[model samples]
Target: MSINIINRSGHPLPAYQTAHAAGMDVYAHLPAEPVTLGPLQRALIPTGLFLEIPEGYEAQVRPRSGLAYRHGIGIVNSPGTIDADYRGELKVLLVNLSDTDFVVQDGERIAQLVVARHERVAWQAAEELSETQRGAGGYGSTGTK
Candidate 1:
């Protein structure tokens, strides 16, 4: 699947560092000094990127596990969906989950972008669904007690 993308930022295009990686590292586009996020602070970090996604697909903005583990930084809306028709610049909603300040620098790999194919469902208007052995069980019902 070839996607048409326009990168307006100073950094290079997002790419996967290794083979078989599920997502590409998305960079932070900051022209000036780094932005500081205090404890529990949230900010929208722009990527200056626009995409022409094909129909029946979506781009998901997800948190970088390394950042989340090292600095306690993560995307507020992890796996944020970018619909196929959305043409605006890509921005990530980042949150500082740690007690200390987290600095967001230019060209920082703040998040990951995963392009995936999804299906559109049509409701059958049925009042009943097939039951299973653990039907209607939710939350921790299937987990170890």
Candidate 2:
């Protein structure tokens, strides 16, 4: 499936690094200067790109595991969604969870974009519902061991 995009970020288009990669690495569109995120601070970093996703599909913005594990940087929303009908710039909300400051350079791989097909649910109100063996069990209802 192909999607339309308008890029003004002066960086290469988002692409999968290897075969069978589900997400495409997205880059920071900052200029020569880098943005610094202080401890516990968050910033909205623009990608300078707009997308046009097809119907019945949505684009998801996710945090990079390497960045989160190495630099303690992650997206404010783990899986930010871009609606299929929405036409707007793609930006990332990054937060620095570590005590030290983290610098985000231009063209740095900040997040990833994954386009997926989704289905809308139709609500059918009813008085009774089917039951299961573990029905209505809250968190940790099943033993850890």
Candidate 3:
């Protein structure tokens, strides 16, 4: 399926792909700029674009594995969710985990956006829920390797 993307700036940005087997496409900026992120600092990086996702689907903002493993820079919210009903600009929230400064150059692939389906839940008020063998077992109660 094809997804429609709107470039608010009225310019075309480069779509990048690191390898042939990659699932998501990396989108670049039309007029790119350098972004400096300090140690343990966070910044909201704009893609200079907006999207019109189909109903019943959502977009997930994630980090690039190469950047996260090599430079220790990753998205704070690992898989940031963008609801289908939202009609706003898409921005990436990145955090620098390295000790030194990290630079984000213009037209660089900083993050990845994956379109996914979300399951809706219907809430109901009830006195009790179904019990299980490990009911209310706090963190790490199962076991450890």
Candidate 4:
């Protein structure tokens, strides 16, 4: 699927890293000096990108697995949603979960963007939902056997 995008970060456009990658790696548009995030700190990292997503579609901003595993860096809102009508710059909410500081360099691959199609559901208010064997079972209801 083709998308309309505007790049003002002076960096290359976001692109898929591999032949069959689902998400396109997004770059961080920061200054020459890096932005340091202390332990438990969070910041908004911009990408200088503006996207015109098609109707019934959205852009999912997700965290980089490598950064999360190596530096404890992750997105504040894992899989942040960008609606089709949005016409602003793409920014990532990054948080440092490790004990040390992590520097965010310019043009760094901080996040991945997956453009997807979604459906709008119509609400059919009813009395209650159907029953199941494990009905109303909250988290961990099914044990790890």
**Which number leads on lDDT?**
4
Top TM-score model: 1
Error of model 4, residue 92, in angstroms: 0.4
Candidate 2 TM-score to native: 0.95
Candidate 2 lDDT (Cα, 0 to 1): 0.94
- Candidate 1 lDDT for residue 115: 94
lDDT score at residue 112, model 4, on the 0-100 scale: 94
Off by over 4 Å in 2: 143-145
lDDT of 4 by residue, 24-131 (tens): 899999865679999999999999999999999999999999999999999999999999999999999999999999999999999999999999999999999999
Clashes of each: 0, 0, 0, 0
Q: Itemize residue pairs with steric clashes in candidate 3.
A: none
TM-score of 1: 0.96
Clash pairs, model 2 backbone: none
Q: Go through the candidates in order and give each one's C-alpha lDDT.
A: 0.93, 0.94, 0.76, 0.94
lDDT (Cα) of model 3: 0.76
- Report the lDDT tens digits of candidate 1 across residue range 102-140: 999999998999999999998799889998988999888
Q: List the lowest-lDDT window of 10 residues for candidate 4.
A: 136-145
